[model samples]
Structure formats: structure tokens, C-alpha cells
Target: MRLLVAFTCLLAGCLAQKPQPCASPALLTGTFTVVTQNEKLEIYCKYEYDALGQRMRLQQQGTYQTKPFIQDFLLLFREGAMYQIFDTNRTCIKSALKDKFHPMEIPKDATLLGQAVLGSSSAPGQGLLVNTWTGDMSDKTGKYLSVVTEFGCIPVSTSYQTNDYGWEVIHFFNNVVGILDPSQLNPPDFCKDTVMKTDEEPLNFLSLFHNLP
Candidate 1:
């Protein structure tokens, strides 16, 4: 049969050699559970990177509910990390960064997910941030973007600027969502004076909350 179909296409091209990533320095922590229509979220992250990879610490913890509204947060990411934080409750909307829910400025179309390993997402609200994509909504406190694998794993797509809707960074989890791109995330410049985050902008853990009180 044509030499058994050319030896089954030469044994599937020598078993397709294309699965090689993860060398050393591994710490793309886990623990996630997300379900979105509006809310029902839980995330636990602990990322560590250095040796010239950037993204030293992106320790995030989130809790969300939408029965009567239960929101708990603690976010701190340095050097522009795509945001979309809300909870106006009509108090002049706190720090005010709204438009369609604002905080956009993390795209130079420089994929490799440099800062924290989040990239191209969807399945969060069924369509994922594409209302016309005007800015950023990559998730730091939104409730979607379960974990998009930027450093590596080849599952890219979280660049939806937003205009009307439909970019995608919703939510999904069962397992194996472990990616640590941005060239393996290496953050250690004493993490910019131990977790910056201050007066107006610039923040990143503050030396793990000043050694926790």
C-alpha cells in the first residue's frame, strides 16, 4: 500500500519532536477554581523567576462571589501587568480607572508573557474581553483569566484592547495550566525596593507586605 503509506509518514515524522520546555528554576504555583457567568472565583498563585527571565513575584490571591457580592482581594504586580479592578459601589469609584472598567497598557504585542506568564485568553464570560477591546482586562482582579501560560506552553491569545466586547480571558480549569513565560520570569532587582506599590502607582508585594506586619 505504497510502502505502507511511506512507513506511516516515517513514523509520524519521528514522533514529532516538539515537546521540550522546563529546564530548571520551577515555581509557577497553582490552585484554581473558576466558574463565570458573573462570578464564582478562586485563585492562588506564587510565581518566582530569576537568572534573567523577569517576573520575580506575582503572588496573587483572589476570592469572589456573586450571590450578594463577596469580594476579597490583594493584588500587587510591578511594571505594568494589565488590570481591570472594580467594585465601584458608587463612592466616586475609589481610585477611578473606569471606562468599561479600565486599566489598559500592557501590550506592545511582545508575546512571551514577560511580566507574569499570562497570555491570550478566553472562555471567561463566554467570549472573553472582546466588546471591542479598548484597553486592558487581563485579570488581576476581574474573575476570569484562570491562568493563561505565557512564559511557555504555546497557548497564546490574551491581547484584546476592547471597544465594545469580545477579546477573551474568561476562565477554565481542570489542570495542567502551568506556564511561566516572559522568558521564564526572572524578577529580582530586590524586586524594586521590596514590592513597590505606593502613593499612586508602581507596586509589587512590598517585600511581602513588609514581612507581614
Candidate 2:
């Protein structure tokens, strides 16, 4: 009877210590591209994020107005600040961004679209599930479908577009990883300071007005 009790206790302890399946909170450092043929725009983005996703550095290199250009976007979530450095104008834009670290999980109210087997076969269980969701009552235009991978990452997402004719964006991430230097997240001193309201930011409104021209 004592041996049996000991065995049961051992089993219980082992079960409690078993590791649970948790997705990586951050993406691997790599480059992704955003190509819009109708707009004649191709943006090459290289991104890096801290393990906790509290800080990120994004570099966009591409061509605009038939000339090559590059820009850097920095997010310091801990400080509630965002900075943008533009190579074309040698300017830096700083603004407050009210963002906080939230654990990644599919929304409880999201509508399940379908299951998808994304990523290479070599990376086992890199599959994702698709879901459609609408934003809070204040924002009706935020309706979209998002693909959530087993790693808790959204590799693809789309805003509302009827019959697929309006507009769409797709991203493909290169499988790469490396240690990021802290200096990469800082904007250069030469960048003249510029500040603007979040809603009035040009990048924030690019999608809304780009089709006009």
C-alpha cells in the first residue's frame, strides 16, 4: 500500500511538471515584402522584435517617385513612444503610441473561417487557422480576416473588400533569425524633429487616399 501511494504521488508530480504548448511570442528576425502592382509600389521591410514584443525596429527600403528611398520605424512600447526616420527628407517624426503588451490569443468572438496549412513542410505543425472579426463599436471599418499560426503569429490578414476587387495586402516572411543590435532601434541625430497627431499621420492615411490618385 505504501509503494502504491508513492507511485501515485510520483505520477501526479510528473503530470504537473509537464510542459504546456505555448507559441513563440515574437517573430524571427527577417525580411518581408509588400508589393502593390496597381500603385507601382514595392516595399522591402526588415523587422526585429524583442522577446517580450515590447520593442521593435522596422526598416523599409524601396522606390517611390522613380527614386530609391528608405525609412525606419521604431517602437518603444515601454516608453509609449514611436519614431519614424525618413531618408528622403532627413527627418524624424516622434509621437506617443498608446500600446501595451497583450498575450496573443484568438478573439473569443471571432468567426472561424477555415484551417490552413501554412509554412514549409519541414517546419512541422506550423499550420494556421483563419478567422474573421470586426472591431469594437466605435470602428466599423476595422472588419477583417486574420490567419493565426500555431506559433501565435499572424502571417496574413486582410481588411474588408467585397468580391476581392477593392484592395488587399499579403506578406511573406523569410525564415531567418539573429541577434539584433540595440543601436538599430535608434533614429539618427541628423533627422530633424517632426510631430503630428496619430490620426493625421501620412502613413496612417496612405491606404485611405492612395487610390484617389
Best by TM-score: 2
lDDT of 2 at 5: 100
lDDT of 1 by residue, 1-213 (tens): 999999999999865533222222233333232232333433343443332222343344554442223222223233343222232531111121111212212233222222231334454533322111122344532222222332333222223222222232323233232354543243223222333323454333222211121
Model 1: worst 10 consecutive residues (lDDT sum): 90-99
RMSD of 1: 16.8
Q: State the TM-score for model 2.
A: 0.54
RMSD of each: 16.8, 7.3
Q: For each candidate in the order shown, give its overall lDDT on alpha carbons.
A: 0.31, 0.53
Mark the regions of model 1 whose C-alpha exceeds 4 Å error after superposition: 7-9, 14-18, 22-31, 34-84, 91-201, 205-213
TM-score of each candidate structure, all chains considered together: 0.24, 0.54
Compared with the true structure, the alpha-carbon lDDT of candidate 1 equals 0.31
Candidate 2 lDDT at 74 equals 76
Best-performing candidate as measured by lDDT: 2
